[model samples]
Target: MLDLRDHFFVPDAPAVELRAFTHGLMPKTVPAMMERFVEDWRERGVDAWNEVPNHWRPGSGEVVGWWTLPETLGDAFIAPLLGAPAGTCIMQPNVHWTVQCLLSAPEPFTAGRNEIVFSEGAFPSVQHSVYQWAAMQGLRPRPLPLGADGFVHVDAVLDAISDRTAWVFLSHVGFTTGEKLPDAALHAVAEKAHRHDALFCIDGYHATGSVAVDVEALGADVYVGGLLKEACGSTGNSYLYVRDGLTLTPRLSGWFADADPFGFQKQPQPHPDVRRRFLAGTTAIASLYHAVEGLRLLLDAGLENVRTDSLAKTALAIEQAEAAGLTLQSPREAERRGAMVILAVKDAAALCEWLKTQGVFTDSRQNRVLRLAPFVWNTTADIERTFAVLEDGLKTNAHQHVVAPASAGPVT
Candidate 1:
């Protein structure tokens, strides 16, 4: 049995690790890369920004010669995996900034296109920012209702779009239930948004490293994500993938956004391409190193392989939960599931607290659903152990919920 738990630095190794979706257990490569990054800084000093060798080749994708330029980011390792064209993917520091940059683009929200549409199931931070964005733009955000099953329904989302829509955005995977929007469903949303002349954006934070993505096939105009969670990387390395040939001038400008970044030209003429007008300032070189290294590890190990094992882990989680009489809040179908399984209970907090005491790690949602996400680092035995602890915890009066429904099926 190939147990992946050993590859990571789990503080409690023998303890069940089902929390990768929240904080990915760092890989061995991260420290190695970071050490090398430090060495570069020590050896190269201020000049290391451009002198540190870039990994990309010239003329690789739709646009080439980025590495040859003065200021460059090597997060393009994600583009191929994301099915994004070269020269279109630029990694920012966080989702808030990425969203702001996307919204602030000159071409968007023009000519009566004032509405912003998203599902209420988006990550709370992202959901919060979009609402604030709506308020800032002087329009209310139109959020789609959660399905009766507590998941997102593509048809319902599409119906909410109108000609007045300026942007269509949603998490590629639902954070609460771990339900992945299928390719067909995503394409439908993209097509519908285009019909309304709206820009389609996918928040790929939960989807990027965990799910197999093909942005072209999904028809997303702009896709944004970060390596903080499932990608086994640290913060400060989030990305935004814009479709090729879409010209959007960035309203948020800095010296790094300059077309000639090194020239010190006071008059900023943004780079004519996707990188045009997009950069906060001097990027965190060390953080960027860890980001690429993490991607490299996943790429070397193979994303499809990671996804296959992820599916099995999640499936095993559901099976174990069901066997222990836990009610599933996430979908049952393999294709519809992401890396985690959400179990509905009366007291998610109680269950989590008990699990932690038992050396098992898991998180809760809305104080009711146990969000168990097993990753490559977990074993089937870990799943079994989690369920065992779960069964024991539920037996005690103190750990019991308000009232768990008699053994139920998926949330529907």
Candidate 2:
């Protein structure tokens, strides 16, 4: 596997960070990118929105200004991560905003279709948006429970699709369980949705950068995700991809999405470019400069290799966990696994805290499952070290006695 640890500023040496599934290590290049942002803002002031140095693609001689970084970066960096073509992708502030915009658009809910289908395993953003939109007087939320196998019930999802279904939303990877739905299953769902004249949308928040995603193959009319996790980009960096020929005029769109903003017309007009219509209000230029640095490293290293590295380390983790008598909550097969592995444990938060004290970082969910994703920056040795601490902690029940620090935040 390609060892790109040197490319990232991994957290303090001798400390193992197993929480790539939550947040990623900062790329060494971010400081320089931030400096360039300051230089551009201080030098040009308001004019920076019109024209700024192309720090994103320096040698390519591309004309990138603060005004166009969203689409420009989407075309150059986010497209490859999604395996999507240029002009079909654009940057958004977050998945919540993107999902809200899609729900607010009238196109998907037209033709008397009034239902949206998704699994209960979806992240709160998708679930919350669907339920919130139900107050619109005609829409119904169809939430299917996971199957006995603890993964999305493919048959139930397919059977739920009907002529009244206006849209079908699915997570490319189950957020709580770390199960990645196979492409064949997603294709089946997409075909059923298309037959019923419903739009198929996917939330790839946990799959992007860690897995090779081909939006076309999955038949997704729309896809949304962020770079805050394994992609290593910080907050305020998310992206959306709309299938070609799809038309959506978001009721939630702001002045930035207007076809002629400077015209200040009384009427609102959607931007001609479908992707640009997702933009709302002024762009956050500072976040854009550092957004693609982590992506650059991943693309150069190759996503397939990244997945391979993750699987190898996670397999080792599972083996060690089993030897230590830890129960697995995530998929045992590599094909069904995303980047993270979840272990069923008692007092998970306390164990997580104890692990942190030992220089091994991990997070827990709902006080039952501890989650970890071994990325390219992690080694098999690190996994072994983590398990060693975990085994000793559990054997002695020492973690149970430790109290959470008063300063610790709610999130593990």
Candidate 3:
């Protein structure tokens, strides 16, 4: 309904992409950005590190170089998305890297506090990193079970926080259920963690562009997310936001994060900028070129508008699913829903494959949960067409007749 399809390059034209929860449509300006990257590399070579044409902020007279693009883009693009202040956010490689960096930091495990509290429904990046740290450090993993409704039980999560809790980890948007945790719930958790002098971190990978976020109001000490999915930027583009005045020294930090690189000191010294301390190695320059292209469209349209569009589209999807007699696996309430909608259908993997044959792209998990997110590029007509095909496929049981691929590769 927003009619922003003109801003994106819809793959294969007529096909309806209902998988923005996994990967977003490429922005129309990516090729030009790529060409600019090629030109800058060709023209400047090694000198590009010190100075290059500021394509990211052209004509604004802002001087940007490859060495500072992480901080520069963080200030121009990511800070506004998170509603965070400047100098507090920086780009990272991915959520996994951010989590690992936090885990490696000595700040969270001070004063004999060794426990990390998180939900069992968390993404592997958070869940796995907590467990990995437990094996190496004097840390304990306290994973709370999901509620009977298959969503986070906020009370249980809050109750789990204690003096032993060093870090409280949670997802702003649950990947498994497409459940968006309410701000009140997140604030309560953050307050509880701070009362006990613990750090609170949120993985907002799926909620970055689709939802309106204010890190200050949420009381998050650290927020990590990526531009790969709903933000429509491609891989190797992730971000981290450290609350102002928070200090963390990571053991896994590489020389790029050193306070002085050319000094070549025998010992490593932490950077004065706390956000820059999260950097590990040489920055991947190519991904930064196209990182904010998609964000430019979303920011230009307004993030609140994007959230409103996502809600309207997802509501239509839920309505269509109910009319088609499919069981909704995701939250039905608009306030608790994220960009994705999940339906519990039999042979979901096969159903996803069949939908692909019908030019409707969706994904499935564990052969039961079929997930789709009707995004900015999708229309109400696209939702109607998808359910039309889904209803027919279910009634005829046609998906069962299809065989799985011999080597289907990765689901995402």
Candidate 4:
């Protein structure tokens, strides 16, 4: 029997050739590719104004810039997630960075000040970042909780709105149950926010490349996504989009954000261009280049194909888990789900370890949910192999405590 762990395990080969359905943390050739891309971009007059030092060095390429290659890859992959145009601004490389940048902006808020709202049960990092941003701006942040259906209660979110609400932030997909928020319902919420003169932002990290995305059609003011989740890219990078004509003051400013970075004048001027204004510091050229390649690969393979295969694999896993009497945590409806499927089982951590011994690879969440993320590289065969290992692991659960030997201390 084929081992799922063997298929998904990170290989020692170069990242350009490595093929595995991973969490999209970091790819192999990212660093070198980024450095080369940046150098080429500079040679093409992209950074002529900045006159920034050629920080790319041999052997010790680690200190190239403030952001790493993984960070750049993370950001670039989010472009598809945000449905932003090719030249859209990316503030910060991760979701937290994007939220913080938005929150810190110098926008004025009054009694009718625009409000920001989000579903409560969304990623805590994003929620907390937005909350902190609001506090810094002296604005109240509102969180509407999800319903028993494990989906964000749209009515509840709408009802929480006040004249002061300026923005509505939400996740395109639920992390806990892998439920997709209705696009029509979300668009209605966006309309409501606009009616209240507020902006709507979405965290598409969970949705993005995993599902079909068309930012223009969604009509959101801003959208954020991380490459690691669905884009088959590295971590530390993320992307954000601000609709074509929407204008807002950027809270964070860096040398790269200046309109004429190469100007030797003591006073610096911010770029008038929307895309350049939000960008701070230098680009993670190495990772960004690799991420572009990964994105191209996904696009070439066709997103529809990826989605179709992902859903089939998820369904298979769910079927097998249910047959084994494991509680399902993911949403049942196909329209309400994404690539990752969740299974609620007792002793999930132990199960994960046991499955590892059987060469089955999977992840467990804090709450007793086992998460099986099958990506474009995964096949139906992998799903079957995983289920077989899980079946064997379940059979040995009763004797696991005494039968599994304790490990000795590592060598000094």
lDDT of 3 by residue, 1-412 (tens): 5768988989665688988778788999899999999998999999899888788876887667999889999999999999999999998999988999999999888789999999998999999999998999868999999999999999999899999899999999999989999999999999999999999999999898999899999999999999999899999999999999999998888888999988988999999999999898898999999999888888888999999999999999999999999999999998899999999999999999888888889999999989999998888889999999999999999998887666758754
TM-scores, each model vs. reference:
0.89, 0.98, 0.98, 0.80
Residue-level lDDT tens digits of model 1 in 1-412 = 2355556677665698777677677877667667766776788776664465443332344332323232244235767669776787876778888787777775867788788888989876567777776777686588888898888978888998988888888888888768988888899999999998898999988887878898888889988888877787777878878888888887776667778877888677877766546676765555776676556656667788888888888878888888888899888888888888888987687677667767888888667788877887777877788888788788774465434335566331
Q: Supply candidate 1's per-residue lDDT for 301.
A: 72
RMSD of 2: 1.1
Q: After the best TM-score superposition of candidate 3, give how far the Cα of residue 265 lies from its true spot, in angstroms.
A: 1.2
lDDT: the better of candidates 2 and 3: 3
List candidate 2 stretches off by more than 4 Å.
none
Return whichever of 2 and 4 wins on lDDT: 2
lDDT (Cα atoms) of all candidates against the true structure: 0.75, 0.89, 0.91, 0.64
Which ten residues in a row are the worst by lDDT in model 4? 12-21
Candidate 1 weakest lDDT stretch, 10 residues: 62-71
Q: Give the TM-score of candidate 2.
A: 0.98
What TM-score number comes out for model 1? 0.89
**Can you give the lDDT of residue 137 in candidate 1?**
67
